[model samples]
Target: MNKGLLFSCLLVAVTSVQAAPISIPYQGFFQRLKQVNKGNYPLVEIAFSVPNKSKCLIKSGTITTETESFPLTITQDQRIFLPYDARLKSDRALVNLDIKGSADNCNISMQVRAKNTKQSYSQKELLELQAEMNTMLSDMQGFPMRYFSQDIEGINFEFESGSQTSVKIDGQRQVFTDKLRLSQEQLNKLSVVEFDTKPLVISPWTHG
Candidate 1:
């Protein structure tokens, strides 16, 4: 969904909460503890959390999970609530975003695993993209700058936010934690919620 569309959706979600009567569940300590590994930073991984009482039906295909589950909606008011809390952590599903940061700063690159039908961005393409990225971030940080040095003889660069799946745009890799900091308008424009939970390692992925 584009930024505009997402903003609209959020508006609608908020409206729904306000119009209806909702209640938060009183789950025990174990219940609350179950939501710990939501693939995001900060133990509670809810981006925009909406909890509920007893239970509710989740439409088919709304998520990729094989089974259906419900924890609760945390709001009783009319405002749309993204899961910023942990009470319903176990009940929520995730949309991961991966990111990496350079010590020098001035660039934001995302790691896109596949493009069209190809498996990884090529080395030659990366250089060109790197040049373009420098241009994009230059204006953001003020004054011109260069990459932090490709001294990757063994410089394992790894930093991740939510699930660790990053998007490779213009040869850069960015995580959800980074993206979340974007303006709500910017986030609404994003659509590729990468399911990247690989922990942003320098090497390949392995199941946690």
Candidate 2:
């Protein structure tokens, strides 16, 4: 599938849920971008608030490149992961979230450093990403897949629930809402979520 066409398809899908809250966690974007480039699966955690009250579940979806469309597998825990192909330029990659369930509106954000990152991309960062994509050598240019790393991480647009109801970043209480664009101040002060998934625990044992 043509990546352009695929993005178009996914963009259309985005519109259907445009009214819902969707955002990219700008603070930890660099780390997530690294993961994407390295072909690692970047997990997206979506939270929902139901004015009408409905449950949502994402079963499966596809990630497309110019030549191929990869399958995105969903775990029972509601984490969405994908085998991102390094050969493809993902700067403009679109994620078509296949959501099941209901709600008055769905809140979407990216999980960066185990904290929900707002989906707003910084203008400068966006420009830089575009430049990188423009400079990246493609498979068509005789570059091998491995050499064509630096996969662009796609912004997440869909989620369920978590223990952490809300978070504070940069000394500001951050709560995600249904909004497409964000301001410069918000982008500049975007918080880097500091939650750790695992912490070491000690058990007493006697050693001679």
Please, what are the lDDT tens digits per residue for candidate 1 over residues 1-208? 2111211122112212221222223232223223323222221121232222113212111211225433333233111223334534455443221112221221111221111122243434333333332222222121122223221111112343343445543344675452222222332344322223422222111111
In model 2, what are the clashing residue pairs, if there are any? 21-178, 23-119, 24-118, 24-119, 24-120, 25-117, 25-118, 37-151, 46-159
Residue 27 of model 2 has an lDDT of 23
> What TM-score, over all chains together, does every model reach?
0.18, 0.30
Best by lDDT: 2
The candidate scoring highest on TM-score is 2
For model 1, what is the error of residue 26's alpha carbon versus the real structure, in angstroms, after optimal superposition?
36
Report the error of model 1 at residue 70, Å.
29
TM-score of 2: 0.30
Model 2, position 56: C-alpha lDDT score: 52
The C-alpha lDDT values of all candidates are 0.26, 0.32
